[model samples]
Target: MTTPLLMLLILTLPLLANRLVGRTAAPAATEAAAAWGLGLVFLFTASGHFVQAEAMTQMLPPWVPLRLALVHATGVLEIAIALGLFTRRWRTAAAFAAATVLIAFFPANVYAALQHAPMGGHAWGPVYLLVRAPLQLILLGWTWGFLLRGRTPKRMPSRA
Candidate 1:
């Protein structure tokens, strides 16, 4: 339920991106990318809720071998990054944070794939590991390019 809603939100982001980029070409694609990237970050967090939906209404995936304290920390970071993405001043920072988080979660994806963990009875576990594992790195690069490169103003201040 939440996953679909988050996916819808992600798909709608391009519309928001178009409007945001139209306002100023300086941030331009970078801002849109940041928004899109941030949306994914939110979507990723939402997906985790699906993984552990049975135990609690909203909770981390129990399969993950991490302390409760670490899980809470991750939740805090996700919310903070989500908030950061909402404003222009923090957009780039949000992108960076989201990218970092994505990279950090790669191992779990890999483990799931390798372990052949059954998700929703759709088992292609190892295949998923091979396919999606690389995606994390690619997304990191895309966000880095979109946010870091796009955010940089093309014109340097003219030295008199």
Candidate 2:
């Protein structure tokens, strides 16, 4: 219900999935977790964008429509990526795509933090943007690592 609790769900879903993966052969739980996590992440980000839209318009040098459209589109993409990640066939691709999305959104986040965008006059404006941007990147990397490890052989340098 609250943003923090929702965030905790977003953060923990993947770990739960990993545990579920060990118990079940199909990894259905893992996929479900990814889907749910991403969906919530998407919803939260979109809502935040609107909450800070007025400040966004003023702070961004870019066109307002373009900025708004991009942010909204990103939310849709997040949901889509989550769905894709949950599918048996698209998990790998989705992981990479999700990482890409996180990377792409970094700029808007930085701008928001730098400008101290008013989240409807909320005091934690800068803190919210600052924390989420880096955390998103880290999470993306973590997801990537999760998707890659043990699936491919790592190369070791020869000892001469």
lDDT by residue (tens digit), candidate 2, 2-86: 5545676776776676676676534556555654565456556656555655554544545546766655565567667767666
In model 2, which runs have C-alpha deviations exceeding 4 angstroms?
Answer: 1-5, 17-40, 43-59, 63-65, 120-130, 150-160
After superposing candidate 1 on the true structure, give the runs of residues whose Cα lies further than 4 Å from its correct spot: 1-26, 33-37, 50-69, 120-123, 150-160
lDDT of 1: 0.58
lDDT of 1 by residue, 28-110 (tens): 55466556655665656644544443422112355555545565566667777777766667777777777778788666556
Per-residue lDDT value at 8 in model 2: 60
Give the clashing residue pairs of candidate 2, or none.
none
- Model 1, residue 101: C-alpha shift (Å): 0.9
lDDT, model 2, position 42? 59
Q: Report the number of the highest-TM-score candidate.
A: 2
State the lDDT at 111 in candidate 1: 56
